[model samples]
Target: MPGKKRILVLGSGMVAPPCIEYLTRNPQNEVTVDVASAADLDTHVAAHDLVISLVPYTHHVAVIKKPDGMRWLGLFSTEPASIKNGNIFDTLCHQLAKLLSFKPGERDLVMLQHKFIVEWRDGKKDTITSTLESLGDPEKYSAMALSVGVTCGVATQLLLDGHPALRTPGILAPYKKEICDPIREAVACEGVKLVEKVMK
Candidate 1:
């Protein structure tokens, strides 16, 4: 395989550890992980080829003060409110697939990825959809920020394995609450269903 790209993941707490674990698992990429403080973000942002910002959406501006060469995969789901519910289950399943690959013992989480659906109630009609792999590709040189509870490694993979066009630049996956909550809930439930139906 070609040498892995030099990647830098910036964040702390819950998301950071797993991000490090996932990215390091693949030898195709060289990952340098760090927890950035407010003061160091600017210099650190400039040093890397790709930056996966696991920071909250509210803090995106602070993290991505300027655009750089790195590819970012925001953990936010960009699906329309109308179809979010049906897709949420599938999204959890995909995420479960990734978690299973990374941490098989954590099957309980798959169930959490299921159960809940995204509810969009406007004046006219209401709709629900799933947020499993609903996340689209990260925009180029932009700060991709994900919200709390975003754990769909599948979407993360999609961002990591961005299309050929992304090669010229980098990609980012910024996850948001609307995207993460359902996946976290559904994955737990789906894991239970999968073990009973297929794995058994």
Candidate 2:
């Protein structure tokens, strides 16, 4: 909410080229890209309202694990992997929790907000907003992993499908619906899922 929007961009892959270029051109937004290891993902993701992921589809569900604040996302691909299969990072967390006596339940609690401002023909203005209060179960999904990986998967898929949106070669931002719409549909077919809600 500062004068500039702070966005966390994850990964350094093919799509990172155009996407990062597009975001940096805008002076009002502060964008930082991180090739963070499993150890640092939580710190970076917590600090930004927006995150751009560019990893493989194999990593999304973990990032989406219920954290209180849900982020608006642009994803690239989806590959199915089991949540029960704990990786090295998981074991590390387990060791830390054991040493510190931190109950796993203490980790749940994510909060996210999205706001839309609308203007009418009469010049009246109103704001529409949505909030997500999430309870994270890292076992269900790794919020850190999904937060940084899902968008990359979606972006990756768009690149592969040659979604009608990438009609140009020179540096271009892929946010247009002509591009986003197809990417969403394509990701759905690939067994990827996304959910959004409006609060009362």
Candidate 3:
């Protein structure tokens, strides 16, 4: 997916810089990098092979669907239970509240760990069950996968490893089951897939 084809990344902000770095460094050999607001999106969609959206979750709806030829990747936090389920939403809110309530000095690695777990449980609870129940559909379930399954690290790895198409170009799920235990490892190994897709 390289060689001068138009690659427009839709954002120039803190959330987008990391993926930007990846694309700039990787060099898709004809890829062009352009940044613009969500408002100017329709103007570029038809000319591009991809649109990496780093917009806020609230703004995600504006760009979720693009022209038939273009590929869209949405980068946002995997929290707050994206599906329309009240019980799941409440659980995420409660956990997020706990993370926010931690005192300033008290916000150590452990607090981050707790935050990670809360985020995981919020997504895992749904993803695992969905997959187990045979209710997983590539098109329908991809939103959930992007929200809970993919992480920055995993996304990066998928691209660097030349396996970008393996998943739906989303973030990797946070570490669990001992394989992806360390946060650094999680980001490095799996989260890169999302990075490569966006930045590339």
Say which candidate scores most in lDDT.
2
> Model 1: residues >4 Å from true position, as ranges?
56-153, 164-200
Q: Candidate 2: misplaced stretches above 4 Å?
A: 1-110, 132-135, 170-172, 184-200
- Please give, for residues 2-116, the per-residue lDDT of candidate 1 as tens digits: 3565667665534455445555666676776677566988887777666776652223222333344111222243643333337754444344333333242221122123333
Query: Highest TM-score, which number?
Result: 2
lDDT of 3 by residue, 1-200 (tens): 43543456565433454455444544552234456655766878767765665643322223335544122121234434344336654444444444333344332120111111123545642111111111223333223233333343235434444552444445555344332433334543423222111111
lDDT of 2 by residue, 1-200 (tens): 34656778787643364455545655766778899687999999999766776753333234444444222221222534233336745443333333333256544344567787778899977777755454444454334333324444455435434556765666566577787776666544433444454333
* lDDT order of candidates, top first: 2, 1, 3
Q: Show the lowest summed lDDT stretch of 10 residues, model 2.
A: 68-77
TM-score of 2: 0.37
RMSD of each: 18.8, 16.8, 17.7
